[model samples]
Target: MAQVPLVVGLGVRNSIVSALLGKGSEKFNYLHRFLGRSIFVASTLHVAPYLHKYAIDDDFVAQLGKPVISTGCFGYIALILISLSSIPVIRRKAFQFFQISHWIGMVILLVSLSVHVPICLPFTLSSLSLYFLDLLLRLLFKTQNAFLGTPAVLLPLSDGLTTLLEIPSLTTGWRAGQHVYVRVFHPGMGLGKMWESHPFTIASAGAEGEGDGEPLRVFVKSVKRGWTERLFGFASDGEVGTGEDRMRFGGAKGGRRCRVLVEGPYGGTGNILFSSFSSVLLVSGGSGITFSLAQALSLQSKALLGLVRARSIDLVWIFQSEASLQAFMPYLLPLLNNASSNKTASSFKALKINLHIYITRPSSQFAYDPSLSTTLLPAHDHLYIHTGRPNLSDLVNAKVEEAAMEAKRLNGRGVNPCGLGIGACGPQGLVRSLRNVVGGLKGERMGEVGGVEVVTEAFGV
Candidate 1:
């Protein structure tokens, strides 16, 4: 009973289900938690009958000395400790302790189970095999060998910063919007010394840069907490943003470097959703633009090659300051430039690519920057910059109108256009608000074709 649920949950981890769900696998997280909770109940009942039958006699102590009996008792202790430590409150407060204890407890329990009922040894071995196989594969295949654990050059900005690693040798191409799990090692310790890894959207795509580029760029807002705070001390992409010793890094002063191991090209609308839709609206907040950029570029690539059905891509990004918008320009420029040069987006003659930039907090100097506008692309209009937070309800309503028009153009009799894939990756609050908007919009316009489907990746701080 215990192993059954665990196996079903852990088995084929990189199976078809994970491939389809991607980072959206959180939907199944509850199932794992529920199954885990049942282990305690099942073990308690199974042991009750044994205790009732044998307790309160000289023979009880003697009987427990047998290998099977003793092993079962020890395994029960292991299960109890693991269950207690796994509670949400305790786990959250002391994750490292919980993690260490969980693994140790699991090992003890599995070893005991193998001996308690020798016939079950195969099951224990199978469980351990799956766990180690997953770990080994993650280490061996997740990282690109050429860029496998390389030191990155960091640039801190007044707002956010970007990291540049030597992915110059990486050959595997990644779609935009997909992210990599990054593990940074201390300088001189080498990238192989990976202990902590965090997921970051690959801000730069493989195909859009000035030349063949590696998955070397990730724009990050250096908020003061955990990994983000430690990053500033290790390096910077521009002028160092924070920390007491904010020194300039350059060739003259041996460029500051932080080693990192890159893993994955995981999860994006382009991989599963965008290719099927004719019109897509990407709503983003702050660095969430990274998620949208990849899908847009990917959809464009496919459309140019007659691979996808998407013809219209609209990006609405919200940032705190104009500097952030400036900092993120590198990601946008290459993608747009690449599209302009690639057959002029000829798939849909009515194809209209919209880039809307909203700055929530403008600096005092914002009043002085002349010519805030820069030429973006040959076919489409340049960036449309707006002030303050966007009216998201209105934004979705407008998208709905576009969808209606698209349906009409398709020669349908009031048939809904293919539903729009509206994706976002940003702050949790932004996702919630967008979710509300999408939900209400969908409900209000039930019969509308080309429904608004939201795919959200909460870019946690």
Candidate 2:
């Protein structure tokens, strides 16, 4: 009970525990709330008996004056505050306040408990030690210093709402679906941004060859305010002036460059062997495309080397408008173009790849241009783009049916059925819908497909 917070809080330093539990640190965040509630309940149970006994004897004042009783009372107050601040509504609406109060409340509770009961010192010490160790590990290994930070190029996508960051220097290998914390250093970003580190999923796959270097890429969407808005402003500042100056400052030759510290390669699909799946479906919404994009690219790279068993791969991406789809054309084009063009190995050519893009909103800035996509993308049979929201249930059912058919084919050939793998990363609503869709699948449908494994990626504090 005492160590629950330790497990819930530790991220990188608790990799062993995460691995043992078959989940990444971020994946188990729901448990943080649960553990917090359990702690508060247990604490109440322990303290209620003492309060009742003191009140019954009419010695409440005397007991309350004691060091242990007073400390315990203070700790309980802190616990109550912590629990209250952690409520979903409060936490979401006032995250900064919630975060600060949580930290302060934890310190008060832990210190009070240590003083209230000497026997609890070991638990308190252990928790503090592990918490600091994770911080130390993040500082020493995960984070690159601002002074030594690598230069990154920022390119605003066609949407005018998202920015693409590319860092060629930091070639550290990371698994697909993993994310990193980035702290930018730039003159225009202000002091507030200098100390802030935000998490973004790695958009590109890892290095394919031993000596080959792959640039780290991530897509950041700017909201109305905060760090991301400033970043977008800085990136687009060069284009503020009219005429030839804009051409000289903003295009491919003069994209904004900023030095940034990258800390991570954390929080990925844990214990899920992607290559083992015979059929794969990757889904993403808006900027969440980064996770699915990386997974698809990595699996394709692995398949080329005969390391993966997947025969077919499908990607379904839902975007707010055509602008977002156009923005991702550069990345999506290669995946579609290279499917059958790899000359080095014939086996790689045999991998069936399909891409589906759904644009839910009409283009707001300009009319949808069909030529931009058609000219860039080849006339591939498996590529599709739709105008409305996708039927998630139908899409999922189609994949399940494909997997079931593949399983029968494999069994007929006396080969083992490798099952289906579904990876989804998006808004909470989308994730919930997908989960319900998958969960609602009949048992026979599940069994016929060998087995369906679903892995989801999401981020929040």
Candidate 3:
């Protein structure tokens, strides 16, 4: 009963929890899971003594038959199911089942819990009230305007392994690193596909100069054999076999048009301002570049307008294969060119930008554009492309040292430097590794760099 409101608060988007704690669901979902486990353990402890007493008194069967006891037993069963199904491996493999079962289990648990213990009614009612209020407000404001659907274009890329979604009409603008939910309408794909909404990070930094009126972009990688696979197929002319088959039919250039509901602009660097830092580092792995790319562009835009305290911005992107580079060239080329131009701009104190690309696997069919290699390669001082995985710890330390040196130089000229901000958005492994590296930074190292702040947006539930 005591944990009721806290559980609901942690689960809901617009709740007192978010208001007081200032963290969105994306940031604190792990805490919700922890509290849920606590509820399960408490429920178990409460039930054990009741069962022991009933058995000792020899009224076990009779007591279990009562309405209160039966309902409590059912609620415990529901809680067990919810807990077991929520295991990461099971949840990822059977997401729909997990999602459906969770909601159903919650309903059963809440109803039975109230009936089993009348004293818990007030607490349960309060939880329900908070949940519904969150739902009502989310529907009325945040996700309401997008229900009717907007025209979207889906273009397959990266040897048909990824689909680029372009929603040109969604020009309302969004914060850097934020994501939105997209529900596409495909008549032939069945009702499940139509009703389901998937979250994808916005790749374009929409409120800025060049980004104004630019379509909201999302790079959907075919990582699983589920909704994303189906979406990739829909975008790639419904090719059934191998990736080569899809590409053989000129699917890369073929663009599919459909309407989709856009439900967010949620989950970003909430109160942390990128412009407030003296140096910024953005890191991403695979498709997670969408978040980092948007952040980099937004920071650059702010710097150009002299609205930022940042003087240096570094972007580190890791790709599994060289072929993946082709899909991002459209965005990468322009960014490199802009960074190169910024270096020569004498009149403005422009942000020094550096782009580091690390390709972990180099296949024989390496599809890098020859023109880009010739033009943007060694000539561009800001772009560095390397083979093999990066030594993240070493790289971070290098940046810290560089920032510290620059701070000392600036201090001699009577200027104090702000802190270094590190933002990472990627797979669990990458984010975890980065976090460990940042955590290891101790007293002198941290202070020499003014200070260091870390923000992360990790993939997965």
Candidate 4:
């Protein structure tokens, strides 16, 4: 029974440490760092009592006179220095020196902790078990591509954004809206050297009858500063040189050169084709449209397979500029055309996909069509173009509610009141906002209406 609290406390500490090391989002990283400091405090508290007991009851002071005790004491002092140096004030004084010393202090801490806990069978075994589990998980991921027989190909699109990639091995076929983990391999950089690998939707796959030579595509956009930027470099072009020189210099040279290791095509906006819902509403911000684009393509392909029938798909992509759309046109144009042609042939029965591009930062070079309006959209749906960054959550929520109301007005029982499945991929804050909006509506509309689903993909930690 006494082990219960200890287990719970250790579990909490483990969670905090894991979050600090896990991939995805700056918010989580900040939380991890904060919680790591708390763990240090807890660890200190845990060790203090044992030390006190040894000193008072066991006359451990006599043992302290030994050389080993002197070494351990110095090690503990170094750990304190490292902790203190992590404070902003001290770190700012000598950043490089502090970083090197921090590593050294970590070595001392690990050695001291091992010695301090040695022969304590329970604690040592527990720690070893956790360590081995982590190692096993890493090993599994490292060999994933070999077992899956897929090679990850990264393509750097212009506009300083990597919006496309190909996986040659996933020829068994991947569904639209499914995401995979990508780890960049940098030679001479050592194993597991690739920083945080984030999830991106498989925007489009090769034709249904296509061979294994065909590659799966993934879309990505760059954030200000993060692990993605560190590994891939800030510039998307091939200008970045390989080897240590590149890491030292930073940024790509002529084109983006990065090797990626992919793992698991997991979780997405629920299987759209198999769902009973007839309509889908896809609302995205900036590069967040990746998953939506994939889903739209998936639904079209599934319809061709004669699997399920969906009424219409309304896609709203909010971007900072028209360039974003044009930049991704190589991938988007085909999907759009297919959806359009299929809708016409089916007499707008099986599936209808309409694209609405919202330009938040319209430049003087690009002119807006005066005749183009949101009302220009079809009777059951429409395309909306905005000049500036519109509130994505508000727009999506309002659109969903409007679609639901329209469905009810038509006495349609199959249409979900929550509207359509919403899949988003982009920066963390934007994703969080969308999640909150979805969460708020989960009980009110989403729970009762089986039509809508929300899927999100974040960049990195």
The sequence of per-residue lDDT tens digits that candidate 2 reaches over residues 319-423 is 887767666777877777667776465555445579998888866554434445455455667788777899999999999988988998999999878788999
Q: List the residue pairs that clash in candidate 3.
A: none
lDDT of 3 at 230: 79
Of the two candidates 1 and 4, the one with more favorable TM-score, higher being better, is: 1
Over 4 Å off in model 2, which ranges? 1-15, 47-66, 145-147, 185-187, 208-213, 238-255, 344-347, 364-378
Q: In candidate 4, what are the lDDT values of residues 91-146, reduced to their tens digit?
A: 65555456567658755654565565454345435544654564465447433553
**Which ten residues in a row are the worst by lDDT in model 2?**
245-254
TM-score against truth, every candidate: 0.76, 0.87, 0.90, 0.63
Order the candidates by lDDT, highest first.
Answer: 3, 2, 1, 4
Each model's lDDT comes to 0.64, 0.77, 0.78, 0.55
User: Tens digits of per-residue lDDT for model 3 on 66-177?
Assistant: 9999999999999998999898899988988888888888888889878987898887788888889987876776672556777877778855688888777776468787
Give the clash count for model 1.
13
Which residue pairs come into collision in candidate 2? none
TM-score of 1: 0.76
Model 1, range 78-122, lDDT digits (tens) per residue? 988888987888876665567677778888888898899967787
For each candidate in turn, give its C-alpha RMSD to the true structure in angstroms.
5.7, 3.8, 4.0, 8.3
Best by lDDT: 3
Q: What is candidate 2's CA lDDT for residue 437?
A: 95
Relative to the true structure, candidate 3 has a C-alpha RMSD (angstroms) of 4.0
Estimate the lDDT of model 2. 0.77
